[model samples]
Target: MLKKSGLSFLWLSAVAFVIDLASKYLVVKNFQLYESINLLPVFNLTYVRNYGAAFSFLAEHSGWQKFFFIGLALVISGVLIFWLAKNPINKKLQNTAYALVIGGALGNMVDRSYHGFVVDFLDFYWDIYHYPVFNFADVFICIGAGLLIWDSFKNKETSE
Candidate 1:
């Protein structure tokens, strides 16, 4: 069943997850909290921990957000696995997207569960204003989301 399904793409998840964890490990080992290393005028490797969701949403809460996010990630991972198992292997784009999401979701979930926060390092900024600090998991998730949108449009085009 799953052996012949999009579950075949699960390796992509492992890759994303491992890269994310490894990057975080390096950051945690070499830098203190709030440490920043300028890599370019617009980019840096900064260390920060998020106890909330994207853009530090609900970051000011009284610790409940950590459990909530961890639970949410778990649910998302389970649903993605079910979807991959149900989808055929021919759904390459969709499967790839799902696998990436699973990896990103689980990567963050592991951090949230173990450290009570997600370690973010990569920082991209213009001159003054800076985007939210993020990690490889966020990159993978954003890429996966973009691919999902692209896949939807591709499917719509084929159906017409």
Candidate 2:
């Protein structure tokens, strides 16, 4: 049987997933494809779709990348769930990391299934340097990965 704290992680995942989906929905409803609405000197809301992995890797491939990413996200999400369920009680940082990753994966999975591409709108750039356009799901994943790394280091420190 799962512990009570385990459910909290799932709840966190649900919130992240909902927020990501809502953001994507608003972007799709309001912006045209490749439309840019300047939000600040270094930021903009530019709607675009990614049919590839991070930084648009393989985006130009002959359409096979879509299924590949979808499968990858699903498999990753499943592994996260398994890890979450098996986590030690009260392991807050580890749980949070899993929740964020699982939520992000499922959020993008929804996009991959419904639109055949991941919708991205948040854009940041300098005059001549532009970061890759990304969405909330990507944010969650990055943050989660960071936390996981932090957790590992903290655990190592405590054991040393």
Candidate 3:
């Protein structure tokens, strides 16, 4: 069971990494920064590079933000990997969530380490209000977080 769980985590992580890298590559190769291709009335693919954490927070910090974020991601990823290794195999959902997080963090870490920023392409806007541009890795990270929350609630209810 432990071996199976490890393999499952590895497989999911690989898939997530590939998807994130491929999307970023396509965005970089096919579109220039700030170029928008409308896919829906409310959604578009806008090439962007984010140098900070989620939602572009601290994006304007003087230079040091890159090293800070990269170091933070590495620490987070290492913790998640350790947790996943320690967790019981029966906790499949929890392990999967950890895998998603690890994958997403590593994906963005790759960008930050190599390109000094994450390449974001997906964009959503309603009238004049625009959400920050993000990419597939962000989606995985958000979904993983939601699932982890749900799993925690479920376990709490089960225990009670």
Candidate 4:
């Protein structure tokens, strides 16, 4: 039987996965690669395929980066799942953090396995500066990471 925390984690992960996939589908079906539709002065819906990790790391490599990223994500996801399983029922925030990261990792893993790249659309920029284009998966992953950091601090304070 799934523990309360475990079930909650799974549910959050499922929701994140669905949203990520749906958004990616909408972007890919509507926009051509490298195309952009401006939504605000600093934001746009831009379709881009990243063959590497965050900030296009190792994108210049010939082809091995695909498998490397896939393997890395898979390992990280497995670890997240294990961590969530061990979490206590009352640790909602930590469970949520794990779930978000797991879901996001799986989402990008799907893209890397099928398309050899991850599809990114959300874009933010200033007049001459820009953030890396990313998708819902990346957003969730970042949020999860932030939560993890916050929880760590909270735990440390409580322990002292």
Please provide TM-scores, in order, for all candidate models, with all chains considered together. Answer: 0.95, 0.93, 0.92, 0.93
Clashing pairs in 3: none
Error in Å for residue 142 of model 4? 0.5
* Clash totals in order: 0, 0, 0, 0
Error of 1 at 49 (Å): 1.0
Clashes of 2: 0
lDDT of 3 by residue, 47-137 (tens): 9999898999889998799998888878988888888777777788898888898789889989888899999999999999999889999
> Against the true structure, what is every candidate's RMSD?
1.8, 1.9, 2.0, 1.8
lDDT of each: 0.94, 0.91, 0.87, 0.90
lDDT of 3 at 121: 91
Q: Please give the ranking of all candidate structures by TM-score, highest first, separated by commas.
A: 1, 4, 2, 3
> Model 4, which residues run further than 4 Å from truth?
1-7, 157-160
User: Which candidate model has the greater lDDT, 1 or 4?
Assistant: 1
40-127, model 4: which lDDT tens digit per residue? 9999999999999999999999999999989988999999888877887788888989999988999998988988999999899999
Who is ahead in TM-score, 3 or 4? 4
Which regions of candidate 3 are displaced past 4 Å? Answer: 1-7, 157-160
